[model samples]
Target: MPDAVVIGAGPNGLVAANLLAYAGWSVEVLEAQPEPGGAVRSDRGVHPEYVSDLFSSFYPLAAVSPVLARFDLAAEGLRWSHAPSVVAHPLRDGRCALLERRVQETVSGLEAFASGDGAAWLNMYGMWSRVGSDLVQALFTPFPPVRPALRLAAKFRAAGGLRLARTLALPVRRLGDEEFRGDGGRLLLAGNALHADVAPEAAGSGAFGWLMSMVGQSHGFPVPVGGAGALTAALVSRLERSGGVLRCGERVASVAVRGGRAVGVRTAGGESVIARRAVLADTSAPVLYRELVDEEHLPGRLLRDLERFQWDFATFKVDWALTGPVPWTAAQAAGAGTVHVADGVDGLTRFASQIAMGQVPDEPFALFGQMTTADPSRSPAGTESAWSYTHVPQHITSDAGPDRITGRWDAAEQEAMADRIEAQVERFAPGFRTRILARRILAPTTLQAMDENLHNGAINNGTTALHQQAIFRPVPGTGRPETPVKGLYLASAAAHPGGGVHGAPGANAARAALGHCGLRTLLHRAQRI
Candidate 1:
């Protein structure tokens, strides 16, 4: 029996296991998949010579995450590579809005669109410079982050606290309209907002959009050298070095409970792994509550709250092994690792509105990735490994495009959707289709099949909407990792600070478990020494 059993070997699970193991608690991590990394894995599935990230590729969040930084993954054979430009949102008329790693460069570019827009961007960055670290620290730590929150509140008060809070709470669209006279600065915020499920008009979208934009400016969206799996490999290596155990293909069937507390888990093969101290689950909140644990052990309020759990939008992805780089009409886009394909802000609005109305938009706004540009090791010299993803409704009522795609993601529908996505790419990169040597389409069903936590193809665990976040996350009345059941912690993206490659949820769970024996405080003391 280990001191801690982490149910899932995804980044979160691995992080939790690593922390526990480092604290001298024997840890065991069980993963259902044949390999780990979950959404963070990569492969040469599209072509033998090209490495395509199966799901997530870029890691701006990971770059800034204090949780991941403590591990010093670079020492464990992890290397990060960045593109010349961070992101580019191009329009049909060859105009582009670009995000450069240097704040001044980004400001200079935005100034071209409107005179004061650059200042507006700089102003936001200034705010970020003041409170960004503490803001991010507050977000990553357990909810009700008392110290960081106080620090952040102090910083905000100096900058007109209530006024700043109102701006953060504004919708992305409204924020853009208020701040910029031209569309360039606005487009960057809105595009980044779409990276989550939030639409431009959605409340509180401004904060996320601004956060992502500032993070991109501060830390260029970087990819692991070689492939995304390298990051996972580093995490695994670090865990092993700390004496943690990883068991792949060991599907946890049920969490064993005794006296209203999690004791261990039973594998599908009838193997029992006992956790003397704690059981930390990196599975989806729904799966953990509905499937892994019996209903008899859960509080009635939790079950009722779970009923309203809303998943983010489903995703459709395309991976390509290109003969050459994407031929973009706007030269800036060619050097960008990630490109947002939409005509303009209005076009993005149309696409998002269609998804909101349960219709697949005719012109999908694709978040395109040039993996080779970001990391040369992803493919051969001069060749490109590329991918793009767009949001779709969980359930479809109509098709806003010609293909009439219903909710059923069959082969024909997948091809049609792929074609539509490619068409959007080709609009920006005219010769995009010609450059594709091979292509693979991952529909919603395909994504869910690949990773069960991406329930119904909804990424981010659940919606990033204001109503489902923070204290409201996973369920109401609880914001921390502790579940209603003692000795059980929710370490998945479904926890507060939802989704992204950041390892906060996992680290929080490990600390929570360490609290059982006052190890967390002792560990901090040791670290200070």
Candidate 2:
């Protein structure tokens, strides 16, 4: 029997398994998919020559995450590729707002829109830089992060800390309105916030926008040289070298519980793997609560809390093998790894509103990636492989609203929606359609089918709103990985620190298990002796 059985091979699952193995515990990882990485996989099947990331590509969080940094992935054949510019948002007037890797350069770019806006950008960046490292350490770790929190508080005096707290709690719209004097800075912040499900007006959205922008400025958004899967390959290599085992194509049907404790898991094929110490589930909260765990194992209140757990917006992604680069009117956009095409802040607001109202915007906000610009290895010479994605309401009905795709996400409907999204991109990148040699569209339904973790096409697993975060995550008062079941723990993105390529959730879960298994305590006692 292994010390633990991890029922998922996503970044979080793999991280937990590797940590346990490093701690002198025998760990086994089981993945439902043929390969690992979950939504972070890439493939060349879309076009025989071009490599396309099936889902997630960029890794801003991973670059700054302490947990991932400790792994030293570069030693395991993982090389990161960065573009000249971190992100570019093109306007209708043939101008683009570029967020460069340096704070001064980003400020200079913002000055073009408004005079005092440059100062505003610097002020925001300054705050982030001062507390950024400690904040990242604090937020990504387990809740009630005392030491990091105290460090951050000391870094900023009482008044400054209070003000910083207000900024973190502010919504994107409000934060932009208060800090920026021009559309340039405002649009950049809002676009970054929309990367998740939080709307511009939603509470606690300011943190997401500010963090992503500053992180991008500090470290240009990077991708693995070969593809996103390269990162996964490196992680798997590290795990194996640490004496861990990864078993793909093993679908865990249920987490076998005995006497109110998780003993092991039974696979869909009727194979049983006994876990002598712990059973960590890297699955959605609903699946773990409703499907994997029997009714007898769950508390009524916990079940109700899972029922009330909200999810992020459903996503629609399109990958293309292009003959050449995107023909953007704004020349600077061509050099950017990621591009945002929309009207402006109002455009993003309208897009969010439509999704909230269960209507798909006729002109949606699209996140376009110029993969080849970041890494030429993604395609042959003079060719490019790129992708774009946008969010929509989860439950779309046939008669949802005006300009909606009927919420069914069928093949014909998906194609029509893709056309709409292409039109949005074409507005900024004229003749964009002409550059495409082949295209693949993954609608919301298709996305859910591709990965079970993306329930209802929600790529983030669960909503990251203020109410659903921290101690309230998954459910109020159940923030830690240890669950109601004695030996079962939640280690997926559905847990705290939410989604991203960052491996905090997995590390936290492993820490919790190590405590229960007595290895961590034993090590502490031995060091003291």
Candidate 3:
């Protein structure tokens, strides 16, 4: 029997297993997929010469994660690469709002839009500089993070506690309107906000937008040098180095619960593996509750609550092996690793509104990635490997556009949506389609097939909206990794701190398990006395 059994080889599960192994616990991570990496995988599917990130590419969150820092992935052969500019939003008029690595450069770029907007940008960065590191710590730790919370409370007091809270709580649109005179700062904030499913008009979007923008400013949205898989490879290597075992293609059938506690897991192959210490699940809450663990092992409240658990918007992606590069009308977009294609802030609002109404957006707001620009190793020389993703409603009731795209995501719908996305890209980068040597379309169902956690291509697993965050995440309960069942933990993005490449949920679960074991040992010693 291994000391612990991890039921996924995704970054979170790998991180949890690695931490346990590092602490001298024998660990085994079973992955359902043929290969690991979950949403962090990369492949040459677009072309044999191009490395296209299968799901996510950027590593800004990973760069700043204290949890990931413990493993020291850099020593395990993980190298990060950045583009000339972090992100760009091109206007139809050819003026682009760019976010550069240097704070002053970002400030200068914003100032071109309006005089005082530069100062506004500086002030936001100044706040991030003050609380950013501590904030990261607080975010990575489990909820009711006592020490970090106290430290942040002190810092928050100094930063005008209540006032700062109100400002951060403001809707991104309102925050933008209050801070900057022109579109530059607003576009940056709004575009970043859209990175999550949160709309600009949402209550907590300002904080999320500011957080992503600050993350980009502080850490220039780095990508793994070779491919996104390099980061996953580093994690796997570290886990193996520390004596952890990973078995891919081992689909966990059920959690073996002898009493009220989890004891081990049964695989799809009818193989039973014993976990003496704990079972850390890196799957979604729905999967864990409804499928893996039997209904008898769960509380009625949890089962009911799972019904209301909201998943973010379904994702539609198109990956391309460009012959040269995206021919952008706006020059700034060429150097950017990430380009946000939208008409304006109003256009973004319209897109979000359409999705909310359960309509296929007429014009999708594409988050386009220039992978080769960010990391040259992603493709052959002079050629670009690129992909763009846009949100569609989970259940489409109507088509806001003329294409009549229902959410069936059949070949016809898939092809139509891909064309629509390409058209959006073409809006900013004229003749973008001309450069595509090959393209791969990953519709919602296709994405889910590759990574089960990305249910319906909901990247974050659960919604990042304010109501579902913190203590309320996964379900309304203590925002810790520990579950109702003993010796089991929810160690996926479904837990507190929601989604990101950061392994906070896994690290939190590992720490919680360690603490439980320590406490149990202490109790046994006390009983003997």
Candidate 4:
């Protein structure tokens, strides 16, 4: 019997297994897919020469995650390559707003749109830089019991700690409008908030916008040396080196519980594995509670919470193998890792509203990524590999089926959506369509089928809204990883600090399990033993 059995070999699961192994426990990870990394995998099926990042590409959070920082991925063959400019939001006209790593340069670019807004932007960063590391450490670590945060707050009191508190509650739309006088600056901040499921008008979205903008300026949106898979490869290597065992192609059917305590798991293949210490589930709460555990075994309140679990907006992804670089009207756009293609704030708001109403927008707000431009090894020489993603409603109104997803779109419909996105890009990248060699489109349904973790293609696991955050996430009795069940823990994005490639959930789960087993002292003893 393994000391611990972690179900899933996604980044979080792998990280959990590694932490357990590091603690001197024999750890085994069971993954349903043939390969690991969950949504962080790369694929050549989209196009032969073009390597496509199936899900997440950029890694601003990973760059600063304390859990990841401890592992030192750079030594494990992970190389981060950044674009000259992190992101660019192109308007319908030829004008564009670019975010660069140099704070002064970014401020200078903002000055064209708003005179003093440049100074305002720098001031925001000044505050962020002063307390940003501490804030990130506090968030990405386990839930604070008011002590660590209070201590950090006291330390950073001179750096506008109270101002930061107010900033977190401010509506992103209002903050953007108040800080920047010009359309370019306001749209840039608004565009960053749209990266997640948060609406611009929502409170707590301002913090996300500010953090993303600051992180972009601090560490330009980075891609791995080869592809997104490089990051996964580094993680897997680190886990293996730390003595973590990964068993792929093994699907977990159920968590076996006795006396209201999880003890082991039954696999879909009818194999049973008992964990001597703990079981960490790096999957969605709905999957854990409804599918994996017996309904009769769960508390009445927990079952009710599962019934009310909210899903975020779905997404549609399009990948292209270009014959050459995207022909851009603005030369600066060619060097950007991320490009926001929409009219402006009004256009984005309209797009969001249309998505909420279950209708595809007439002019969708598309986020295009220049993968090969960020990392040349992603494609062949002289050609560019690119992909763009846009949000859509979670439920399919065209079909009233229980699955909530309609039939796959015909080729014409897929091409039409792709054309609409390209047309938006053409506003900045004039001759974009002329360079397309091959194209692949993935609807929200396709993404859900690819990774069930993307429930209804809700990429960030669950909604990023304020109500579901921090201690309230995934139904919040205990902010720690421990579930109501004694030996079970959540190690997925549905936990605190939410999604991105950060490994905090996994680390938190392992730490909690260690405490439950009284292995914290044993771990320390073994160090001397």
Candidate 5:
């Protein structure tokens, strides 16, 4: 019997397995797909010589994640490449708001937008520089992160801490409106926040925006040198070096529980692997509770709460093999790794509102990533690899409704939706459509089909709203990786710290699993003696 059996070979699952293995626990990781990396995979077969990041590209959080920092991926053959600017928000007038690596450069960029906006931007960056490390440590660690929280409080003092707390809780829209006098800084914050399911006007959105923006400013949106998959390869290498085993193309049918304790898991092929210590799952909460564990095994209240679990908005992504770099109206945008294509901050908020109402806006907001800009080897010298994605309502109208595209993301509908996204890009980068040599579109259904974690196309695993985040994540009353099952734990993005490329969920799960396993080992040794 292995000390631990980790289902799913995503970042979190691999991280969990690595930690367990490092702690002298024999570990095994099972992946349903032929390859690992879950949402962090990459491909070059789509277009000859063009490397495209299948799901995720940028790694602002991964760069600063305390969990990942411990691994020292650089020594494991993982190299990061950063673009000149982290992100760029282009306006209709061809002016672009850039977030640069240097604080003063970013300040100057913001000053161009409005007077005193530079100072406002500095205030936020200043706070981030002082307490950002503590904040990152606090957010990424398991629930009740007392040490980091206390460190943050000490830095802010009593009165300043209260004020800072309120600032962190401000909605992105309010933060932008209060801190910025022009469209540049406001759009930057709102766009960054929209990376998650949270809307600009929603509570807790400001924190997301602030965290990511500061991360980018501190560490320009870094990408793996070869592709996003390089990071995964590094993690897998570390895990294997630590004596963990990884098996792919194996689908877990159900988690086997005996006497109310998770014993192991049975795969679709009818093979059962016994886990002597713990079973760490990197699947969604619903899949673990509703499908893997039998209803009779769960508490009534927990079942009810699982039914109410909310998912984030679905996403539609498009990858392109470009003839050349995107011809942006704003030259500064050409240097950025990521660009936000929208009317402005108001346009983004409107798009979010429309998504909330289950209405696909006429003008969609798209996040464009320039792969080759960050890593030139992504494509041939004269060509570029690019991709973009936009969020849509999770529950779309089943049938054709007034002024809607049926919301049924079939090939035809997907093509039409892709056209709209392209049009949005063309609005900022004129002649963008003409530059595409080939393109592939992944609808919500396609994305979910590609990765089970992206259930209903909700990429963040679950909603990141204040109500569903923190201790309330996965389900209220239990969010510290441990489940009601004695030896089962959730080590996926659905856990606390919500989503991102960070490996906190996996590290936290490993810690919890090892704690009990270590105690049991001592008990067994005593019994043998």
Candidate 6:
């Protein structure tokens, strides 16, 4: 019997297992898939000579995650590489707003659109720099008592506390508009919010926008040296080095409950792995609450909350094995890791509204990743490995069981969507169509099949809307990782501090389980006995 059995081998699961192993408890991780990393894995066979990230591609959050920082992935064979420019949002006319690692360089680049907005951008950076690490800790860490925020506030006087409170409440759209005279500057801020499902008009969006923008300035949008999977390889290596055992190709059929407490889990292979102390589930909340645990076992209100869970927008992913680099109309865009292909702020807002209404935007605002530019080892020299993703409504109900949700894209339709995205890219990069050697498209439905953790292909797990964030995430009970059942905990993006490549949920869940399991020495003795 393992001291702890962590179900799922995502980043969160690995993090939780590592923590337990480090604490001197015998840890075992059971993963459904043949490999770990969950959404962080990459594929090379999808297209010959080109590697593709199946889901998550960037690492802005991972660079700052407390759990990841402690591990020092760089030493574990994870090499980081950044684009010359972090990201570039191309306009209709060929002008672009680029974000660089240097604050002054980014500000100067924005000055092309607005005179004083550059200074405003710098000022925002200054403010964020002071409390940015604390803010990240507060948001990524657990909520309710928000220990990081309280500690940060205590360090400052009463006035500083009030200022922080006011800043938190300030609308991001208003802040962006007030600071920047031109639409370019405003769109840059809005682009950051679009990284998640959060709308630019949302109250907390401003904070997210500012935070991401500042993070870009602090650390460029770095990619792994080989592919996104390299980061996962490093993580697995560290976890194994810490004495954690990973068992892949093991599908957890159900969680075993004994006396209102989760004791262990049963695998689909008819094998039972009993946990001596706790069971940590690194899966979506709905999966744990509705599928893993019996409905009758859950509290009434908690069940209702799970029933009312809101998933964010689904995505259509397109990966291309380009014959050559994307021929960009604006040369600067070719060097950027992320390219926002929306026309402007109005165009993006219109797309957002269309998604809200459950209609696919005719002119979708796509986020493109120049993988070859970010990491040359992904493909053959002089060629590019590129992938782009666009958000669509979660469930597009039609006569045939929800078109978007079912991922019923025939070959023609798949090619059509790919063509449309390529055309969108061609708008900024002429001759882009000629560069495609082979292409693979993943409809929302396909993504769900690939990783059940994505639910309806909602990347951030559930929507990052105001209603589902922080303590209200998944359910409004104990914001900690603990579920209604004793010894069962949620350690996925479905939990607090929400999704991203960050492993906070896993770390948070491990801490919560540790509290229940007792101190390091006690857990060790209990395991031995």
Q: Candidate 2 or 4, higher lDDT?
A: 2
Candidate 2, residues 1-529, lDDT tens digits: the string is 8999999999899888878887878899999998898888999967989999998999999999888888888899999999888999999788788898788888998998889889999988888888889889888878888888898788777339688888888999999999988888988899899899999999989889999999998887999999999999999999999889999999999999999999999999999999999999889999999999998988999988777899999888899999998999988888889998889988888888888887777788999999999999999988789999988888764323345467777777888888888888999888999998999999887877778999867988899888888898888987788899999999998889889989888888988888887676643432221
What would the per-residue lDDT of candidate 5 be over residues 1-529, giving only the tens digit for each residue?
7989999999999888877877778999999999999998999766978999889999998889877877878889999999888999998688999998788998998899899999999999889888988888888878989988999889877337788888889999999988899887888899999999888889989988998899988987899999999999999998899889999999999998889999999999999999998999999999999999888778998899988899999999999999998999998999999999999988888888888888776788899999998899899987889999998888874322234576677778888888889989999989999999999998888888889999867888999888898889988887699988989999999999778888889888888887766665633332221
**Candidate 4 C-alpha lDDT tens digits along 1-529:** 9989999988899888877887788988999988899888888977777898988898888887777777778899988988788988876466678897788888888898778878988888888788788778778767863655875687577776676688767877888877788876677788998998887888888888888888888877888887888888887897788788889999999999998889999999999999988999999889998999898787899888767778888888888899998777656678788988887888778887777767766677889999988888889988888999888777645421122234355565566666777777777677888998888888777787777898767888888888787888887664578887889999999888788888888888888888778876854542221
Residue 396 of model 3: what lDDT? 94
Question: What's the TM-score of each model vs. the native?
Answer: 0.98, 0.97, 0.97, 0.94, 0.96, 0.94
Question: Which pairs in model 1 have colliding backbones?
Answer: none
lDDT of 1 by residue, 448-493 (tens): 8888999778879999998988899988877799997899999999
How many angstroms is residue 132 displaced in model 4 relative to the true structure, after the best TM-score fit?
Answer: 0.5
Error of 3 at 336 (Å): 0.6
Tell me, by TM-score, which candidate is best.
1
Count of clashing pairs, candidate 3: 0
Q: How displaced is residue 256 in candidate 3, in Å?
A: 0.7
Off by over 4 Å in 2: 397-404, 521-529
Better model by TM-score: candidate 1 vs candidate 2: 1
| lDDT of model 1 at position 32 | 91
Candidate 3's error at 14, in angstroms?
Answer: 0.6
Poorest 10 consecutive residues of model 1 by lDDT? Answer: 520-529
Badly placed stretches (over 4 Å) of model 6 are: 154-164, 397-407, 520-529
Tens-digit lDDT track of model 3 for 252-285: 9999998899999999999999999999999998
Q: What TM-score number comes out for model 1? A: 0.98
Report, for every candidate in turn, its global Cα lDDT versus the true structure: 0.91, 0.88, 0.92, 0.82, 0.88, 0.81
Query: Candidate 3 vs candidate 5: which has greater lDDT?
Result: 3
Candidate 1: deviation at residue 162, Å? 1.1
Model 6, 1-529: lDDT tens digits are 9989999998899888888887778889999988898999899866867899988888999888777887778889999988788888887577888888788888898887888878878877777777777777777666654578786676434337676666655666776777788766677778887888876677888777777778888887888988888988998998799788999999999999999999899999999999998999998888898788888778889987777889888888898899888877777788889988887877778878778777766677899999888988889999988899988777554211122432356676566666777777888888888888888888777887778898767898888877887878877765678888999999998899788888888988887788786685644432221
